[model samples]
Target: MNKLSGHHHISMLTKNGKRNNDFYTKILGLRRVKKTVNQDSPSMYHLFYGDLTGAAGTELTFFEMPVAGRTVRGTNAITRIGLLVPSYASLQYWKERFQQEEVKHSDITTYAGRDALFFEDHEGLRMVLLNHHGHEVPAHWQSWDGNEIPEEHRILGMGTVEITVRYLQRTVNLLKNLFGYTVVTESEKEAVLQSIAGEVFGEIVVKELEGPSEKPGRGSIHHLALRVASVEDLQEWDAKIKEQGFDSTGVVDRYYFQSLYFRDRNGILFEMATDGPGFTVDSAVEDLGKKLDLPPFLEEKRAEIEAILEPLE
Candidate 1:
């Protein structure tokens, strides 16, 4: 059985940190659960948006990397992020809102027997609001602007994501053999794999691509992470990845959660992360995302780090 609960979070690149915050918190009505900096490059911000409590599977994170430029579409990168909604009425509500906000979006379309509203963020990050047909419905968060978005229509959490791979079978094997994902649905061009146990947040639609490899930049996915039970589980998975001849990052402390990163056959980055000592580790839930927080190792440079980061509205 898969030891993972479901999707822990999906991290993507964005050009402007402030705009990214507004798009998610204001427009999408998610809560800004954590405001921190990229561990690898402390100057750039690493922001997280999720439910009121920053629950697993609901978290969507971003790294502000404007210098990376816009993403180049091709094989081996995550394409669309799907957030779950309650019903068809929610889909209808989004269509009208998209039109009013002048956000580019597609009319509701059917996929896997659910209604999906496809759209893009200001930075051209593809996204979807799909009905939670077979997934657990997480609690909706109160928007910072107070009741701007109705509770019913608010997004539940991260639902599904579309990934483009060069060869379908190789990627499929890795998910099935390693992650215990089973083929829930398949078509000529794409296939949907779900965790054998998790009904929500584990949906991964693999689409075959015929083109030059994707060039990473702004709006490109940094990595997609799956939730593990504990640190021991992470170590076990790390060993499994190495046994499969795929290079793994072993284990790294992410402060909130320990992580292990590895790339697939197509070089798309994947991470297995534990869910504990979370955002509340450094700050209280009420004060989350209100101020900048840093890991203990970086505490000495807090003053220097604060100087470089632009103020968020």
Candidate 2:
């Protein structure tokens, strides 16, 4: 049986790479693990932020689009991203911190049966910080050397990602019948599905709404990448997707990890990515995100790429 783990990395679009870097690293207290360009679009910046070494599930990435417009909210989308925090107290700390930073946010509240605090980035990317409730996600707290965030109160990693579609049952059916996930909670309009890998980090919430597809722009989530065990696992899934007659981007080498992309019946794009040959492949753990790095395929165009891109720092 193939093992599809939790999150690999959730990719979104950002208009200003510099401000996005400042918010995620300094404000949210995540480390910039990689600074590279999008492989498909070499001139655009691809920035990654995560815990210490940029673990697979911990990575939150952005592709910079300099002239992108605002996202028009609607259904048939990956609506909200969830970040895991250590405790209830950590939520309070972040609540105060966000207020001080003038970030848009909401009061502490309950979401999907966990204490969660909803917030948004400058460009209106929706997010929530959920209390992990002693979940054993490998978030390295002592990794920050000069950072001022308290050791005990730091964001762990991503939690449940919410997907809103017109037909929740079709999406739920795809996750269950195709991906082998179990429903944790279910209702007429919303349902939370838990991955077989088993953790809040690997789960997804599906909501049904009668509306049009989301008009995506800056601050819009491009896709959600689920974690798979290895390159071999991805190949098996690639074959399975073909066997099922679903449209897919067959197994592709991403340099860091191998992956395959396919849209579910609901039209939400999901990538199954491997967990190894991580960000540390190009740079040392301590030196990660300190400088621009590119894969071998894109190495020859570094000078040209750098010339066209705006400085992130």
Candidate 3:
């Protein structure tokens, strides 16, 4: 069975780019590695934030669409994204930081057998911090305080993604048959699936929605990307996705990575993204988030794009 390794990154729509930037960079301390515009909507900005190199598994991206409606939360969409932190101590530190910064947060809770801290970003997108297991700590995860967090205590990777769906069978079948996910557990309202070996990454939780359809809007997840090792892997998956009667766009070059977008049987947008030419392609590891980068394709139009984008600082 070919299974995805874990989550790559989750993309969301936000109304305020500056506020999002300040929150993720200044407060959360995630590095802002890329400052570009959305290919579908060049007039708006697209931002990427993550660990030092903005590696595949440690990224959170955003599409700045101020006019997009507020996303309705229900079934058939991504509910929240989880980020694996270093340790229980990091969690405690964050709890204090959130309070000191006047950021609203929830008390600790146990989910998926791990302790977690739940919070929202400036734009109201939901997020979770967990003590991840079974992966190497990222080399470039900068600590908030001058104190050092041992390598053994750094984040492992994204642990899981929550998906809401109206009907379980179609989504479940898609996961089992097409995506190579095996049902790990099941209940009346939800089922958990683990990806087949050698796929992208992350566990997927499919939850049954009990209400009406939802409308995608701000503070809502736009799509969740599944990691593909390279362009060839993505092409293979693209063919596989299309063969299953689902339409998939050709590989699109995202400055730091290449990706193909498609939706699952349940209508949640998914991206198979590559891990090459990472965040360091444009900036040094120590100086990521210091500048705005334009992909080669968009270089000629840089002046125009720059004119339209709001300044991050």
Which candidate gets the maximum TM-score versus the true structure?
2
Among all windows of 10 consecutive residues in model 3, the one with the lowest summed lDDT is 140-149
**Which residue ranges in model 2 land beyond 4 Å of their true spot?**
138-146
TM-scores, all candidates, are: 0.95, 0.97, 0.89
Q: Best to worst by TM-score, what's the order?
A: 2, 1, 3
- Model 3, 1-313: lDDT tens per residue? 2345556788889888999888887677676777778877788988988766677777888999878777777778888787777678777877887898888788878665578888887667887877653444434344323123344444444666888888877777887888778788788878888774322136777889878767788888989888777788788888888999998998988868899998877888988888787877877777666676777777898889888888989
Query: What is the C-alpha lDDT profile of model 2 across 45-163, one tens digit per residue?
Result: 99999888888888899999998999999989999999989899999999999999999999999998899999999999999999997667744322454467887788878899999
Q: Which residue ranges in model 1 land beyond 4 Å of their true spot?
A: 133-135, 138-147
Q: Rate the local accuracy (lDDT) of all candidates.
A: 0.84, 0.88, 0.75
Q: Residue 67 error for model 2, in Å?
A: 1.5
Worst 10 residues of 1 by lDDT: 138-147
TM-score of 1: 0.95
